[model samples]
Target chain A: MRTLLTGNYAVAEAVKLSRAKVIAAYPITPQTTIVEKLAEMVEKGELDAEFIRVESEHSALAAVYGAAIAGRRAFTATSSHGLLYMYEMVWWVANARVPLVMAMVTRTIGPPWNIHTDHTDLLTMRDSGWIISMAENVQEAFDLTIQGFRISEEVDLPFTVGLDAFQLSHTAEVVEVPDQQEVDEWLPERRQSYKVLPGNAVTIGNIGPNEYTAKLRYAMAKAIEDSRKVIEKADNSFGEKFGRKYGGLVEEYRLEGAEYVVVMAGAWCGDAKDAIDRLRDEGLPIGMMKIRYFRPFPKEEIKRLEGKEVLVVDRAFSMGYMGIFGMEVSSVIGDVTNVIAGIGGVDVGVEDFEAMFRKFASRKLQRLEWWPREVFS
Target chain B: MLTEVMILSFGGQGGVTAARILALAAVNEGMFAQAIPQFGAERRGSLVRSYLRLSDQPIRRHSSIKKADVLAIFAEKILKIVEVREFLRDGGITVLNAKHGIAEKSYCVDAAGIALSLNLVAAGWPIVNTAMAGAMAKPLEISIESVINAINSTFSGELARINARAAEIAYREVKKCQAGSST
Candidate 1:
């Protein structure tokens, strides 16, 4: 059904369609609505699921982790401080190889205290062995979430779908929600290699020797690397079934003969695309490479823009170094302009992107520039 | 064509809900729309603003509307607090919940009166959002029927009936006037 929904509600709809057996989460700004909707569905008997009201985000993920290990499809969602609060359990769940889906409505981590969009919170899990994907809009938030379960279950990995706080979470837009029968036909039952059954006495994540720990880490690394294909395949299958396919790991927009490419992720990519379109209409050779999947970083796709003038716009930065995403893209493309913009939800509109593209095309922008310069000045 | 609307209202006045209803109405009319409520640490009676974008094509830009093609003020008192002229584009339409029109392309409607007449009072405040939404339909280029359907689908029972009636009354009574004109 085509209906208007916020990204949070769309995610809840996806979870309902995915038939998540367990829903556990702690309330946090932006992310609260996703789980709230789920709880409402559960209460109204519209969805058959156990809605666990955990006191903290830590217990939220832990509850879902326990449920997933018991071979039940489970889900949880958090943002900003809530995600940080669940940091330890995040690693535990990922290393345990329990298939679960998490909706991360990304918010800025703060000392002054902010509840707005940024990638810093989600990017903190870069090496946690979880599959991370970002959605650019409400429809993709629904699509990526449904696909997250399919990919996670296939690879026995935890998946986190990130959408910008407020921009996607609070903004209501049209989303094509697939029928439960259609989703069920596309998503199979949760496949766990080994379930922690009631009769089975199994001690998972026991104390391991140095080599054993290294070996487990190696396996996780290999599984995630292999899961890239699974991600692509799931996306292709979803596209075929739902008639909507965002490019597997990275979606490209008019990058064919472009001399300059802007790479970004999250909801702002929509604005960036609009900027690129306007710039292209003005005869400027600029395109955008939106990173749909952040973890298992799209190195292959970044390599395609090797010779082009690549500009990476990161909403989150790795203090004392540079933008996290820019660092990764630069590592692959050798040299690229890195601009740290939109931090703490400082609005970066189409005009801002158009100006950035124009500056990059004219070789006027510095290699690393803080946007809305006055903030840094 | 893209029409951006900025709705200014006090918190708890359903300014955000008004934007949502209008967006839904636009969608029901086979157009793409986005309703973005400015999320903030706000309380009841605080100044709040929400945005709506209606377009024939998909809306890719998610930023806050800097210059709005239409400014819908839910409370006439909000005019004293917020400079509506600053947010509106050149020759933009103004839909004010007031007895008199305030701008060159202003549309005036007694949304509060309609809401009160319909007994649509919540927390001692007249619920003028639906009436204001109906007052906005003509200027937004969306059919009044679509707005009515959206209201019906959004609310339920007798509340939906009264709210839809308020919208209908406001739609019929909304008057367009020149700058500073009472009629």
Candidate 2:
């Protein structure tokens, strides 16, 4: 059914449709509404699930991790500080190879105290063994979330679906929710590779010798790398079932024969596409490469841009280095223009992108620049 | 065509809800719409701004509206406090929740008076959002039936009926004015 929903609410709806067995989350701005709606559903008997109210974000993920170990489909959501608070548990969930889903409403980590959108929070987990995917709009948020469960379980890895803090979280748009029966058929019951039963004796996360630990880490590294095909398969299956598929891993918009390509992720890609369309109308050879899955980093897709004049727009900076995504893209595509903008949720509109592409096409932009300039100055 | 709408009101006046209702109504009318509430640490009675975009095609731009094609002012006095004129595009239609029309190419509805008559009071303040949403339909180029359905879906039973009634009255009683002359 087509209904109006915010990105947060859309994720919650997907969780309900996925028949998540347990939901434990500590409420934070942007992310609060997601769990709030789930809690309401659980309360009203609309969804049959245990709405676990934990004291902190740490306990929230830990509870979900525990639930997942017991072979129950589980979910947990958190934002900036809440995510940081659950940092240790993040590694624990990933290393344990628990199949669970987390909705990460990306926000800026604060010193001046902000509750706004930024990619830094989610990017910080790039090396943490979790499958990370970013959604560009509310419908994609819903699609990626439902896909997260199947993809995670298929790879026996945890998956995190990210949407911009307020830009996507609070913004409401039309989302076509699939029927529960269809979703149930698409996402079958959880099949656990290993479970922590009461009668079984198994120790997870036990201290091991250096070589053993290194080997386990290597296995995890390989699993995430292998998950690339699983992610693509999940997206294709979802598209086949629901008639909506966001080009697997990375969605390229008007990149054919383009001279300048803007590569980025998150909600702003919608605005970027709008700007790109206008630029295309003016006959400018510019397009956008939206990174749908941030990790395992979509290396193959990034490699496709090897010969293009790429401009990487990163909402998260890597302090003393370049933008986190910029660094990654540059490492693959050689030295391309890396511009950091929209940090702390400062609005980057169509006009801003239009001007940036214009400057980029004219070769008037620097190799590394911070939007609004004063942000770094 | 894309019609950008800016809804300006104080926090607690249901500005965000108004945006949602407008967007929902647009969707019900078979158009794509997006409702974006300006994000900030806002408190009650402080200024609040929300945006709505109704388009024949999917809305891909998620940024806050820079220039609005339709400006809906929930409270008339906000015009004094904020330079709202800068945000409205030239020749854009203004929908004012006022007793009298104040601008050319504008529509006015006494939303507060309509709300109070309908006893739609929340937190001791008149609930003028639905009524204003009703007043905006004609200017927004959306059918009043869609607005009524949206209000009905957003509320329940008696509340929905009263709110829909308020919108109906506003739709019928809204005054279209030209250069300060109310019609």
Candidate 3:
């Protein structure tokens, strides 16, 4: 339906339609209202899900894990410190391939104690075996939530849908909410566990030999790798079902016949899109490629942006001067020439896009200057 | 031709709801619109920003409206938050929820009074966004019925009727403001 909704609410609706039976979340900025709205849904009998008001993110994911193992679809959400607190569970999520869907309102880590949008939180969890996707706007936020459920369940891996905290979480955008019946139709009832404990009581988190362990580990890797195709198929099916086609794993705008492109995830892409429109008005051939599905690291998918001057905007700095996405993009470009402009900020404004575009237009590697290293020091 | 209007306001005030009504009205006019929330708005006593990205074209990125054709401020206190003015395009309107009046440059209104007269007392507070939206709509040639339809879509049951009425009253208030100034 054409009801207007926020990115957070869109996620909540997807969670409801994903047939998740448990929702465990703690109140955090940007992501607080998502759970709050879910609680209201459960309270009003709008959703049959169990809304677990956990005291901490650690317990929140733990609660979700238990629910998932009990063979019911499960969910949880966190941001910044909350994700850090639950960092330990990330391994569990990956190792278990829990098929849970989480919405992380990506926020900057503290010390300065900021409550704004950034990618550091989600980037930190990039190595987690979850199928990750960052929303470019509310539509993707809504669409990705549905896709996350499908991909995670199909691959039997958990997925984290990233939205720049405060940015998309709070930003209202025209999100085409699918009919509940359509969502229900698209998202089949996910079997929460491999098998129920009908006296068969097989062990989860089972210990194994190195060879056995390796195969299991690769299963997690395989699922993560498999998520790209799964996402593509889901998006294709979602489009067929809902009349909204979100360009599978990555959505490109005006990229054909363009020379310069800037990359970003989450709502920052919105500002980038407008900037592209404005710049295009001025006759700039610049374009934007939004990597919606972040985790299965669609290097081949990003190969389409190859020869163009690429500037990967990493809101969260990787250990090396590049984020996992920027690194992977650069790696995929693989000796192909492109300037990497690494910039970090909470919920980038139009000025940031303008700066990046100017840098790209000139073909300069503005990394050392654009990065926020002085603060990190 | 997507017209995205981002209103930055504080909680307790109706920034999100106001954006919804405006965007909703735009939809009634047959435009595709979406309202998304942002920083400073989720917590009580904090500044909030709700953005309406509308276009004849389908919106692609879920980014904050960097340049607003109209900037609606629901809280007088939050006027300085995040350089909302920077997002204003040339000749765009900036509406503030201020008491008395703003001199120099601004589209000002005491939206509370409009709600009171409309008997939507609960819809009052952060009064300026609605009034500003109400006032700006006419100049932009957006229909009042569109605004009414938007308010109706978001507000459930009785409040739907209430906010729609408030939107109408707000429209007249803006009209009166325009009249008092020019004629």
Candidate 4:
């Protein structure tokens, strides 16, 4: 059924439909309503699950990790500062190979105390050995989340579905909610190969030698690589059942026969699509390739942009480094004109993008620069 | 076709609810729609903006509306807001909830006075979002019935009827006037 839902509510619905056995979450802006709605669902008997009310995001993830280790499908959500606070446990869950899913409602980190959308929080955990995927809208938030559980359980790694803070989190749009029976048939009960329950006791988290540490790290790295197949398989299987395919690790939009491509992710990609359509109508060759899964890092997709004018817009910066997304893409694609825009909830729209594309199309852009500075200011 | 509407009002004025209802009305008509509240400190008596977009196809632009095809003001004082004035597209339509005279390409309804007369107050301010929504329907090319149906879905029983009445009165009472009349 088609219903108007915010991005946060869509995630809660996905969690319910996924039939997550345990949910431990601490409230934070943008992500608060997601877990809150889940709690309401559980309390009202709409969803059958244990809603663990944790005082802090650290405890939230820790509780979820405990649940997952005990052979249960666990879920949690946090944003910005809360995500930073959960940093230690974030790495722990991945390294421990606890198959859990978390919703990272990407918000700008503090010092200035901003709660609006940005990629810094999500990008900060990009190297944490977790399966990271971003959603472009409310429907994708729902779809990717259900897929996140499948992907995580397949590889025995945690998954984080990154959603832009207020842009999609609070905004309402039409979303086609899949039927519960259909989703249940698509995603079966999570299979537990190993559990820390009674009678199946095994030595876990013991001190290991340096060589053992190297072996564990190697296996985790190889698991992430091999999980690429599982991710694709889940996406294809989802499309077969749900009629929506998000193109595995990366989604390409109007990239063929285009001279320039704008690379981005999250809800901003929607704006880029509109700008691309407007530019195309005016005889400009431009397209966009949205990196859906940032952790697996779509090397093949980035390589396809070889010998093209690449404009990468990063909503958050890495301080001493250039825009993190631009740096990563440039490292792979060789050269990219980075547009570091919307750092602290600043708005970037179609007009702003039109100007950027015009500069690139006319060869007026000589080097990388922050947007709105080059155009607006 | 896509129509963008920007609603400006004070925090306690139900500006966000107005935007949501308008979007729902559009969606009920089988069109794609989106409603968003401006992200910032939301406090009573403070300036607030809510955006609405209705399209024949899927509405994908998730950014704030920089330019609006239609502008609605619940607080008459918001007319002095240069940013709000600048957001209107060239030759755009505007609906205002004010007692003062209106200008060309604009419609004005005494929505606050109507809300007060109807004894409709939300958070100590006369509720005008519904009335303003009714006034917006004409310029937006949406029916009064559509607005009323959306209002009914948003509220219930007596409150719904009161809002529906507020909207109906505003729809009929809005006056068409010349251009550049200060409220």
Query: Global lDDT of each model?
Result: 0.92, 0.90, 0.71, 0.88
Top candidate (DockQ):
2
DockQ of every predicted complex: 0.83, 0.85, 0.46, 0.73
Stronger candidate by lDDT (3 vs 4): 4
**Candidate 2 per-residue C-alpha lDDT over A1-82 given as tens digits, one digit per residue, 9 for 90 to 100:** 8889999999999999999999999989979999999999999999999989999999999999989998999999999999
Chain A TM-score, prediction 3: 0.91
Q: Could you tell which candidate, 2 or 3, scores higher by DockQ?
A: 2
Which pairs of residues have clashing backbones in candidate 2? Answer: none
The stretch of ten residues in a row with the least summed lDDT in candidate 4 chain A is: A366-375
Off by over 4 Å in 3: A198-200, A278-284, A304-307, A335-347, A371-377, B2-11, B34-38, B41-53, B60-68, B71-89, B94-110, B116-133, B156-162, B176-183
- Checking candidate 1 for backbone clashes, the offending pairs are none
Off by over 4 Å in 4: A198-203, A374-377, B80-83, B101-103, B179-182
Between prediction 3 and prediction 4, the one with superior TM-score is 4
| lDDT by residue for model 2 (B1-183), tens | 989999999988888998999899999988999999888665789888999999999999888888899999999778778887787898888888875554567888889999999999989999899999989998887888999999999999999999899989998989896445332
TM for every model, in the order presented, reads 0.98, 0.98, 0.85, 0.95
User: Model 2: runs farther than 4 Å from truth?
Assistant: A374-377, B100-102, B179-183
Best by lDDT: 1
Error of 4 at A222 (Å): 1.4
* Rank by lDDT (best first): 1, 2, 4, 3
Model 1, span B134-183: residue lDDT tens = 99997887888999999999999898998899888989999996555333
User: Which ten contiguous residues of candidate 3 chain B have the minimum total lDDT?
Assistant: B174-183
lDDT of 3 by residue, A54-153 (tens): 8899999998988887778888888999999998997797787777888998877887887777677787877778777888777777777778777877
Q: What DockQ would candidate 3 receive versus the native complex?
A: 0.46
